[model samples]
Target: MSNWKKVLSLGLVLLVVAVLAACGGNDEEANSEENNEQTEQESNTDVNEEEISIGQINWAENIAVTNMWKVILEEKGYNVKLSVLDMGTMMKALESGDLDVSLEVWLPVQDANYLEEYQDTVNFSDATWFDNAKVGLVVPEYVEEVDSIEDLNEHKDLFNGEIVGFDPGAGTMEVTEDLIEEYNLEFELLPSSEPAMLTQIGEAVANEEPIVAPLWTPHWIFSEYDLKFLEDPENIYGGVEKIHHATRTDFADEYPNVSEYFKNWKMDDEQIGELINYVENADEPIEGAREWVEENQDLIDEWVQE
Candidate 1:
């Protein structure tokens, strides 16, 4: 072996090692950047993220109640974003930490599964936004000789043996099914969308026809149409309920000021019912909430102002 051959061989080996090292370093850097981007997206926190995110179920009470918070929060220098979703879906999102807050959780009416499962991950408001919320069968003013669920069995022919219901996933549907089994009532539970059910009831009431449906309080239906909840002698729908706010477990820690605003926030049945009435009967949600806020500035200022 010659000295030049040995030296050249050693230099070649060193050059190959340096090239591999450089390739490895590039790969690591690329991976780090990708991970950073992903984290940023999941967090989705704005650089100027002074806004508070609130989740809202598609019910009138939820929409109105949450919007009331939105108004209060905004007045206190916090921007607010209301994310509207279905009841069940909204609960799942709140449990998974996808949403920030929900102010429409009705006690004993909404599913208990999420409440039990995500108890550790969620926090409920100290004060209830509204009470007197209810769920049960309702009949129009024109429905004579039928004033109770028990009375329905005899008048099956009047309603075609079908009891109209709201969306399939609604808690009212669950209670209605239970009511049927408990009483052994002979009737079909028609699960339809909110709009569909409302349209049917509206038409029936307009023409003085008999109509039955799943109904709740603090809703605009009473204002839109003359209706009465059938006497639930069996009490299958549970008693009066209270609505409150639920947020991520870390919400208070992350946004203390916003949490304080939510904590101090409260409204009576009349205030919230009026808000719902505006959204449903008044045909204007955003405008209605805004007008309500403008008209009731004193009440709002009590919550946020000082």
Candidate 2:
């Protein structure tokens, strides 16, 4: 009785110890797997946190180019956000680093004041996207009588005693106000948005009525309408300017690749006009930009190449 009972009890104790050891090993393996999964998830979050914000103005060319870059950056695995802002707000955002980049900045004249104010805080691209850009009072070709700013005063009534203008804070509108004072024109400068000004132009042109409004080149409107820029004898609206992109001062150091892309970015009249046309006609602006990006893969690749 003593020998057999002692042997059985010893065997049972050994078996129980072996089973507990096996269970501890499994627990360790499960914990290791769980930790590895957590690390992988954290790594993916790091990758996805690579985000960029682009500021866009409501202007036609600005809208076109901003969305185009948004699509391109998103394709390159960036979490891109597009923020539509007004001129003053955009400039301030860039200065404060609230916005990462802004694609459309008319320089040497159109937005000279903004550059002068924010140059210290914002970094402008080395290369311009478009050149020979003009801004002035535009009239349909049918308003042949009003060929120059000097002639605008005489025909103020034709434009309904108002010069249909773009947004109030826009550089174009500022210049238009100065033009009125310089020319001693009686017409009031109406402050409206780009789309509203375009609608006014469209309606007046369709009816063959005279309508003078603030306008700029590289815009789709010129392509769609028979229009002429009213000659500025005083040259208040400076000669051809350029369109440039700007970013927060620290943006380049943080995102050198994106900064390089902005530096290399450029577009000619035909190219920008085509983009604007696509954006303007499409049901959704971003979709239009996506279509353009899809069609211009080679061009984008060239831009993004290291």
Candidate 3:
């Protein structure tokens, strides 16, 4: 217990305590610097983005809904691009990220094919409009000879032994073919484009001639012409279908505001039917959509949610 020994021990203890204190301070400083760096990195990653791309088909429902979104998204200070494509091609585009959002995806019926294939890769919004879709043997109301699908086969000669049909790829067309088989009808399901089919119907109706064509709901023809769907007793044509909006899975995340607006969009049979009529009467589809948007500013305002 000499003085020198005691001083040496005290000095060693002080040296150890000093080293521990320095290490703790260094650890604290290192943690603070790491956290600051992480915060800055995250802030740097948080960029404001505002552009979106859309894909749509040429069909009546698709055209109307797609153009409708195109007009509104533009009004919301977001750059929106709408590309016209076939159903299959549109699905492919959405999957590849070439497009951001798409319109008029009919579920459990018309768009069943596309949804089955791309539901994993794509995201679907809640039904914009519940499925009120109808596909049947549509005839001008003037043709009183055929009231139900059964009556059509009896007067096949009136319809010229031919049934006009829309694009071959459409879901209605597929079911129509099945309908023909299911009913065992002796008729030809002629495949033609929408415009061509419309032209035929217009010409036929102009002269009050009889024509049986495969048609659906929310179409301009329903509004402009007196048409009736042939009663389907066998339930071959199935039931009403809903229309939905679709996008790449990352769509809602990348463009949350736009996504919210999409989810907010809802329309009924009359509203959509009116839009289709407007488009059918207008010179061009986009102009028709623009006119509709202009006329329905209040509804659009409601759809653009905060």
Q: Rank the candidates by TM-score, best first.
A: 2, 3, 1
Candidate 1 local accuracy as lDDT?
Answer: 0.76
Q: What is candidate 3's lDDT per residue for 1-306, written digit by digit as tens?
A: 999999999999999999999999999999999999989756533224545778866677778877777787777656777787766777788899888777777667666777788889988776565457776788999888888998877898998899998777777787788888989999999998887998999999999999989888778778778999999999777778777888888887767667777777878788888887777678987789899999988888888756
Best candidate, TM-score: 2
For every candidate in turn, the CA RMSD to the true structure comes to 11.0, 4.8, 8.7
Worst 10 residues of 2 by lDDT: 41-50
Stretches of candidate 1 off by over 4 Å are 1-51, 109-113, 280-284
C-alpha positional error of residue 272 in candidate 3 after TM-score superposition, expressed in Å: 2.2
State the RMSD for candidate 3: 8.7
lDDT per residue, candidate 2, 1-306, as tens digits? Answer: 799999999999999999999999999999999999999866543235767889887888888888899888888767889898888898899888888888888888888888888888789776887887998888899887889989977777777789888788887788788888988999899897888989989999899988888888888888789999888889998998998888999888777778888888878888888888888889999999999888888888888886
Candidate 2 local Cα displacement, residue 159, angstroms? 1.8
lDDT of 2: 0.85
What C-alpha lDDT do the candidate models reach, one value each?
0.76, 0.85, 0.80
In model 2, the runs with Cα more than 4 Å from the true position are 1-50
How far out, in Å, is residue 50 in model 3? 6.7
Give per-residue lDDT, candidate 2, residue 251. 85
Clash pairs detected, candidate 2: none
Better of 1 and 3 by TM-score: 3
The best candidate by lDDT is 2
